[model samples]
Target: MTIDSPSLAPAPPAPPGDTAVHPTPARTPSAAPERLSTRAKLVLFVLCAAQFMIALDFSILNVALPVLGKDLGMGQADLQWAVTAFALPSGGFLLLFGRIADLYGRRKLFLTGLGVFAVASVLAALAWDPASFLAGRALQGLGAAIIVPTGMSLLTTTFPEGPQRERALGISGTLLSLGFTIGMVLGGAMTDTVGWRSTMGLLAVAGALVLLAAPKLLSESRHPQRPRIDVPGAITVTGALLSLIYGLSTAAQQGFGSLDVIVTLVAGVLLLAAFIAVESRSAQPLVSLKMLRRRSVAWGNLGGIATFSMMSTVVFLLTLYLQEVLKLSALQTGLIFGVQGALSAVAGVLAPKVIGRFGARNTLVGALLLQAVFTASLLGLGVASGAWLALVGVSVASVGHLGAIISYGVIATSGLPDDEQGLATGLVTSSQQVGITIGIPLLSALASAHVAVLRDGGDGFAASTLGGIKLGLGVDAAVVAVVAVLVAFGLSRRADGGVAVGGRTGGV
Candidate 1:
């Protein structure tokens, strides 16, 4: 095996059952190295930078949407695509690309994804029309599909599994959260002062820098016995995800009555079912159906969906309340979100310690419960409710979000062998993107349904909107409560005197 390597993957756990899940990939000696070299640190920095870039792109557009629409002469009715385009590919293609990264070189794929992302950013920035801009966003989503899974697989492979890997993942997680916060704060300021285009342009510049450094700093790694790509599996799964998410997103705007939405949603379900059938029969499947049977991988992903989905729904509703009801400026809205972001950053750092004490399942359950409680607290919001209440509630919930991120990630990825790390990361990443993509639209529909009744009762537009929003929060809280129970009961007792999920005891 190659030595003195610059792998981005975290070293796996101690191999269990004769599996090579935790290989150091020619890096660390059998014993821990006394220290990492400067080159190793640089390589890590580049990887984190790539992660930060992906996360940044996800949030930067949040505050800029209104102005971007206005400047391009786009109608409000047609503007959702700017966000949907990115979501469709990012959430859609993750599994396919994760396998591709394993077949191709991680370093090469990482660099290529960055290049595509950068070029797409330029297209978005220079776009003079909605079509071109949506196209650009779609391409960005494709790059995200490539970047996220590979970046995660690299980080896992690069670091040693114990404290070293924990610390590295913590830092990487912090950067990812920081990117979201930074984007919001920066989006508001840049959109107000420079132009919304600056946000896209900024991504291009950041992506370019990461692309340049990655090839020089990061080493390539792949499976020893190469596996064939599963094309049918890829097409079916991506199509399913994109179609489902698109259908739901359309519901937020056009309601559930649209024929297009119904057709797509039904197609998505059918396609997902088909993908499962294809996977079961394929000699070389894109995703081994057996992986989903791993309780930890399965339940942890469900928990991840809960984490991102609820948080995103809360943010979306709060943004609407802040801007539309209270008439806050984009800058104010960004700053408000920035506070939660800062708290989220702090939580990210402490998440590892929290998990150690609580255990993974308990941590996830508690976090979800906390998020549910805080989200439900927003149900009391009204004209009398100050922005400070919103801030405190959102901030507190973000702390739970931190725990959810750490626990769910560890639960899903731990104990997996090296060859399957890409697949694991892809699944985890897809849950997150899907959660973000569908959360807003689905919740909005719930809110709208409630609002409709309030309007019938003679409430003003603002009051009806608020009433509808609170109902949505109540439902969101209920979801967390139910999932928390599911997470608690999901594990079976293991032989090693530990709770077993993914059929592993004591994490490989």
Candidate 2:
């Protein structure tokens, strides 16, 4: 099931007219090397900006969901779809886009994806109804699927390994955290004052600026050997992920035992199995299965899934508590959440230094443990608790969670080679998206079940809801605790350098 490096394969000759655009044979990796210049720095900035836009879109819409629902006459189900539609495609299509980038040129794919994303944002802003808006969101997700991996590949290929790549990755990771925070603040303000549509328009402008700067700043990478597209493998995998995410989204509305949920889950599992089989036999697989054999990649992705699942659930539940329980205005709630977001940005900046000092595995384990403790404390806050206490708990928990997230990114990407960095990035990002997709339903179900128990014991709606929320947070804390233990044990078993097979160690 392993996909070997395509660099080991023979390359096709370039067409005569393509010579000018393509790198000359003398400048190839096999010949004289060219170092990235100052111009490349500008290109890296543009690429990072595009990455920020894509990441921001994921969280930005959360604060605007109510406004969008009201304006478009969207019901609960439709509102959920508006969010899920974007995430499903973004996660499902990442591997496909990563493979496409490898086959074509990274720079070409990055710019193309950014252009498509910008256009999609414009369509999203112009939508007059739920269906049209959801359609636009889905298209934007497809564009993100292309933009993310290609951007990562461009950074990896452009910057030489060592201080340069480390600095680039650090900046890239920081921007991602910054985007998530800014999305909340901007989404809330725009939805309140200008309208949700204006928020999408802002994204469009950001994307356009990135596109304009890309050409002048970026240079094309040396094309890899001609690689065949793994169409069947891609289809199967994408289908599997879509089915799984759809099933989870459906479970949020329909109980898990429903026939539709069962069918979709079963079908998804079957399709994913088929995808694995196809990859094993395909000449050029979309995903390198052998990469999973690396303990760091596997365990790091696992930790990422758990970490994001907790994070997504916490954010959702906290927002609900702030608005419903505490009766905060959207703007006030956004400002409150902004505090955590700001702290998260700080955490992202400090995470690498913490990891370098303590080691990635140890840092991850510590962060997760701190997250679990803070999450459990937050769960202890009853409806009657002081507002300040709730705010303090959330802010502290967020800081811990942010550190855990950055550590997970460092752990997952640290071990991969330049060529395989895209694969690692795609897999880890997909895992995080899957976590977010599943978090809502899974936590909601747990909370609902707790509410049922409390109601049976004569609790009222308010009491039952608070109890349910607490129970859900408790469940998330337990999950994070398990992940922490697993990470600690896994790291302890690794070699002295903490390098897993097929992965490097040193940066974070």
Q: Point to the candidate with the largest lDDT.
A: 1
lDDT of 2 at 424: 70
RMSD of model 2 against the true structure: 8.3
Q: What is the lDDT of candidate 2?
A: 0.73
Residue 445, candidate 2: how far off, in angstroms? 1.9
* Candidate 1 TM-score to native: 0.91
lDDT tens digits by residue: candidate 2, 1-508 = 1111112222232212200011011122210112334565676688789888987998888878877999999986668888778887888888777777766767788888888889989999999888889888998988898898888777766654323444456567667766876798888888878899998999899999898888877766523574777889989999999889889887878879989999999999999999999988887788877666555677777877887888778877877777777677878777877787777777766765665455566667888888888888886666765457667777777777767776666666653555566677778678777887898899988888888999999998778888888889899999999998987777556444444322122333
**Candidate maximizing TM-score:** 1
lDDT of each: 0.78, 0.73
How does candidate 2 fare on TM-score?
0.87
lDDT of 1 by residue, 426-450 (tens): 8988888888777878888989888
In terms of lDDT, the poorest run of 10 residues in model 2 is 18-27
Q: Which ten residues in a row have the lowest lDDT in candidate 1?
A: 18-27
